[model samples]
Target chain A: MKINRREFVKRMSAGAAVTALAGCMSNAGRPAAGRVVVIGAGYAGATAAKYIRLWAPDIDVTLVERDAEFISCPLSNLVLGGSKTIRDMTVGYGGLAKYGVKLMRDDAVAVDPVKREVRLASGASLQYDRLVVAPGVDVQYDTLPGLASADAQSKVLHAWKAGAQTVALRKQLETMRDGGVYAVHIPKAPYRCPPGPYERACQVAHYFKTAKPKSKVLILDANEDVVSKKGLFMAAWNGPYKGIVEYRPNSELEDVDASTLTAKLQFGSVNADVLNVIPPQRAGNIALVTGLITANNRWCGVNWQTMESIKVPGVHVLGDATLSAQLMPKSGHMANQHAKVCAAAIIAMIKHEPVNQEPMMVNTCYSFIDDKNVVHVASVHAYDASEKTMLPIKGAGGLSDKANELEGTYALSWAKNIWADMLG
Target chain B: MAVAVGCPLNAHAQDANSIRGMAATCANCHGTEGRSAGTVPGLAGVDKTQIVQQMQDFKTGKRASTIMQQLARGFTDAQIEQIAAWFSAQKK
Candidate 1:
């Protein structure tokens, strides 16, 4: 019973067209129809909103975001390294409008899952049949000492969100002396991007090696070692960046003197011309307010099958906000994968079709070791029915053999292709 | 010959959405509907057998790539065949 590819597509298209026409007719007759409201216009939310509109045009989909433009955090380190600019990374939401997704330029202050309403900062409330929340992560600055005051915190930039703070940190780096020390403090596991701080270290080191050869990059890591692509990162640090980058493991940042650009470690303190304090993070603030942080009160927990909150029905969590199964990296690519699985499930639920039981996702993360050398880690994950979680499919993916100039070229091409897929 | 190679994929038409969902992940790098907008080769309209053979080669490390080798190993033979069929059916 084999079906040819052409026959399959033809049948599927015919079925879809007929179903969609019926859905449109029904939607036109009903004044109040199915509406899905997505919070946060990020990798996950944007993809979910667009796909929902593309798959189920009868459903009213609205994407609520805090900013007018989306700034990618994936390649933001290049901005700090002077290889890219904020403008180059920022994209407007106008492109999503073509998919019939309404863009709401406002912050989602509160979510009433039981009431099926989201209250916005602009004194407006949106009702939803289903809600997709992808608010990313919120850094806890209060956990770090000497960063309680707005004035003090201004000097120590995280730049993890990839917007104003990114520009500020880049500017600070530009103003530093040729031989100055640039310090970066990384929090423990489950931060936004697993390989981000290491990649940042590499990018900054590359900058110093070329533009400020005498300067140095000091990486203060709380983790035991580089969490992702450790071998590759270690090779880069010991090889091309031997003299420029200094990596210290188990050096958790206890406090900071932003005024003096001094990091207070358990053993001692180190002063730098510029400091980047990326504090411990949890799910976005809205998730906390909505009681979605069911796992250790740090991240939202959802069923791996549908990405729907285990505690709240009809509410889904995606991207960095969710406590995914072990071995899942909190990455943009994973978020995009979550969006597709979630979108498919939501569409099926609305149309009374059987949701796909076996969902497979793939993630590939690239790290720029230098301006021309890049390394990567990739894996495929599949839902385990018995385990009730997504686990890596062994033998399907691994780290790059080594960082190389060709990977660097692929890294750029990857960024361009992904951004177009998400926004174009 | 190409059409014959794609026959096995048609049996799983009931899982069309799942197949499409998995294939969509490739678009992040391959381009929308596999019509690459960059230097990465577009998969749309490529021969199913060619796509399947290349993926198998990548999985086996016969074809060296910065990322594809690792990515190719993510799927089983059947899944790879289905993905190849999906893209091969797309317009060039």
Candidate 2:
């Protein structure tokens, strides 16, 4: 316990040593703090990693990210519409280094929770006092036929993850004939980004309006009605792009035929020049491999106060991977909010301080109907001691009155601020 | 950490971190610790009275906003005072 700070730094791993030195400088009299290994550098994990170091500089934070750059899923639809490029949504992880978070550019292939370690694909192991898993979502192709193979998936792009496929899908629309039908199949509810599919429709339709007037944007939704920002999206579809966009609800997908570019629905089949099928989704692969999917074997359950896994000790799950509370949506903004709360809890836990009994989080999601006009859904969730969960505050959140250029500006500004908040 | 500067002696130290967590929800649009990076106005170093009053106006429809009107109504009066103080204490 009386070991010198320099000795401790030399004894620790490269990743932990630098942070330990920083901690020693800032926290002169304190002991070297515990280690926190966070998996997936999306909105949640990146924010968590940064905030943990910001608040409690003594703790060693190592962030594991497979991708060299972070491509945002929000505003990715603009790339599909040709309004923005993939570079606009991509950012580097170098910002995290400034906060003393060691960036481990490797995949966390396995978790040994009992031994309190994570095994990376590079044959390296990370031991942690706490593990944060924010693996976003994994789109399951096996649930749908003709989409299980790589060739079929290549032909019918999901573009849901917002990277290369986003650009490829844009290419498909650009090359499609003037009058060709570009159909997008929406999966059932509880998918990532509830209003994403509809916003995507508007984006594609906007492209169709300018480039190919006769081209149609078809929305085949499995849900009975619009899932989020219903009135706002309806107004856009009816008022602006009335002739261009078509909506068919309750059109459940039985299978897909990539060769014919047809979506085989339970009722019938519809052929299209470009078929974008957003298949059913579950928690990411790491969540699956770690056996943390507790809800319907799809989402992990967590203690709302700390986001610690209900099934496993010392492991916390965040963002879309967790079973959402009553009113929470799987949006990046909400994920960022979740990261702050998790970071605060982890810091307090490390310091043996009392975790906040009352926690409040807010979600503000903006969807661009076109490039300039946007609609949004906002809500606030407060921790309820009685229910032991976060409950949406009544009358505090709602949809935008309508789509407008002002909110569209706020949408981009929001993206810039949030990205800076997480990555920087 | 700047939140501790202006905190009254009567304020519970633990409650400071609690308010910090609550105030961070605003950082998605506002910048970290309310130092905005984009079109949204930064909240850092603003007067507590001004911040609280604006939040009250937004909540009561006295101020018009693209999204703040809806977000302001979420916080109770007491919570707004604490959050305002935290942001007010931060450097611009």
Q: Per-prediction DockQ scores?
A: 0.41, 0.47
lDDT tens string, model 1, A1-424?
8999999999998887776555534222233347899999898999899888876787899999989888999888889888889898888888888889999999999998889999999999999989999999998877686998988878998998999999999899888999999999999897889999999999899888988999999999999888888999989889989999999999999999988989999999999999999998899998899888998779999888788998889999999999978799999989988998898888777655557888888898988887778888888899999999999988777888888888787777877777777777
Interface RMSD computed for candidate 2 is what? 4.8
lDDT by residue (B1-92, candidate 1, tens digit) is 74335333322433888888888889878886788877788899999999999999998989877778878888889999999999999999
Q: How do all models score by TM-score?
A: 0.91, 0.93
lDDT of 2 by residue, A225-304 (tens): 99888889889889889999999999989999999999999998999999999998999999999989999878999899
Query: Alpha-carbon error at A190 in model 1, in Å?
Result: 1.4
Scored against the true structure, residue A377 in model 2 reaches a CA lDDT of 92
Instruction: Record all residue pairs in model 1 with backbone atoms less than 3 Å apart, i.e. clashing.
Output: A3-B10, A396-B73
Error of 2 at A117 (Å): 0.3
In candidate 1 chain B, where is summed lDDT lowest over 10 consecutive residues? B5-14
Choose the strongest candidate by TM-score. Answer: 2
On the 0 to 100 scale, the lDDT of residue A289 in model 2 is: 94
